[model samples]
Target: MMLPTRLQGSLNNELNDGETILWLDQPIASRMARGAWPIVLFGIFWSTFCAGWMFFTINMAMKTPADQAGLFAWLFPAFGLPFCIIGLGMLTSPIWVRRLALRTVYVLTDQRAMIISRSFGKTHVRNYTPEKLNDINRSLNDDGSGDLIFEKVISSHTHTHRNTHSLGHGGHRAGGGRSSRTRTSTTTYGFKCIKQAKQVHELIDGMVLASKPVAEQD
Candidate 1:
């Protein structure tokens, strides 16, 4: 599908010489509705509870005399502030995600796949070359819109540290402590919530095959 004029203009300026656009599209709005009900419910519960706590704390603080209020009265409102803000943010996250989709564009080119996103007054672009891609997967929604995960990169790190503590026994001291921590993170890249994801996936696969050298094709 042809992109809108404004979107096309922005993409055109970013294209490399002789690179051709094969497919381009934005995410569907209903994408937000998929697997979002649980989050929405949690947000509602969290925000309602936090707001009530905030109001109650503020009212109690106001009713307490300044001299008697002390640190406890002041601390209550301070404690409630972060939770209130976080809850409100959670409640509004779905709306934010949907709005973000409006400014996001996905492009498939002969040489690479590109994602253009404009958020918080910043424009960011991500490009993935076919040769560098790994573990391509797809998840389709009932309505034929889905996500194409072209790469899954898993990174792991482990750290070990020793601590010494003094143990006094008959004028002798001994100490030893060892701790280890491991962290794993997985990052997936590709078109998210695009229509005709299977078709797009197949098209990209064909492009990748065609881009291979003649000797590699055999």
Candidate 2:
């Protein structure tokens, strides 16, 4: 499927001359499936927890003596009402996270790269000619999902520092502390958690090499 024209227009104006192409870090379907599993598991656990709390509250309220009844019974409904509402609200985060997870995006224009990451709105962009790319590779996880990897797409000419961080602290923190350090390294674009990563890597490798001038090859 193609991005709507309005979204296409939002691409940087500098990307005008050459064709624009998009790729996902993983297939959209695979991502959706992966994302849904967590939500389902969460619902199951949440329901169990709520049921336990409800049962406990009701039981405790029954055990109170009639003379003390006014206190515990009134307290039960007040506390339960809020707890129930909050438990329902917990559903929101997973749904939103799952929706975002279903997408892994890459935009390749004549001279730069843009990557939209998983389960969140983190977008990473890089500006560099193909000649600057040092290498490209495909990476896969044990679960058989993967993403294309672009190594060293930063060079002196295409480099700019306008956009600093993509997929900030929370997005990458789950995989560990890899993204925490502050540094002055050049930014590169890669497919993150997409299916068929190797295939995308090869396609990019070919495109980068083909874009090179004969003099550069020599």
Candidate 3:
């Protein structure tokens, strides 16, 4: 879908039509943003149940024929601990997944595409405008992991650099030194465990690079 006109430059200057707002997959958003706590709670409960069951089973086994078997008894507890730990960890995977989902935020605007990460407030806001956009590149690994890395189109001016740094890092050193680091004008966007991520990356990268004038094309 075409993005909103507000995001495009110059009211008179025609720009490629893309959707104004492309929200991340709603299923992803629902689980991460709205249903995270409940899911986490469910996971905790389930994990606890399995852990308890495993512990009980181990004790019972030790008390049963295994213990009477003598030499094999010590091996039971030794083997049980690792299995318990692994099961417990498996149960907690949802929490980690939830946190990852929570950290993800995606927005596309007229002037830029913004990603506001999950923190108390906007922790990471990446803006990709035409000027700062150096190059839009997409790469996919054999396993289907893909990324769209927006290269900084142009170096940040003194005032823009200073202002961005101030807001981004509380005025501390950011992006290495302002002089040495050419600030990225884009965000790192990827889909975890999602199929066809490379196609999506390529589409966005094409739109980004297409914005340049013919003479500017490399």
Model 2: lDDT to the true structure: 0.55
Taking all chains together, the TM-score of candidate 3 against the true structure is: 0.34
**Model 2 C-alpha lDDT per residue in residues 119-203, reported as the tens digit of each score:** 3333434444576545655667776657556654444443333334456566752322232323354653465566566666666
Task: Judge candidate 1 at residue 112 and give its lDDT.
Answer: 87
Query: How many clashes would you count in candidate 1?
Result: 0
How far is 49's C-alpha from truth in model 2 (Å)? 2.5
Better of 1 and 2 by TM-score: 1
Please report, in order, the local distance difference test score of every candidate based on alpha carbons.
0.81, 0.55, 0.49
What are the per-residue Cα lDDT tens digits for candidate 3 across 79-188?
A: 55665566555556566656655455444334455544444432444556755544545556576644445553444533333323333456555443333334435434
Best first by lDDT, ranked: 1, 2, 3
lDDT for 196 (candidate 2): 60
- Candidate 1 Cα misplacement greater than 4 A, ranges: 1-7, 70-75, 153-185
RMSD of each: 4.4, 13.7, 17.7
lDDT of model 3, residue 204: 51
Query: lDDT per residue, candidate 1, 54-78, as tens digits?
Result: 8888899999999999888878778
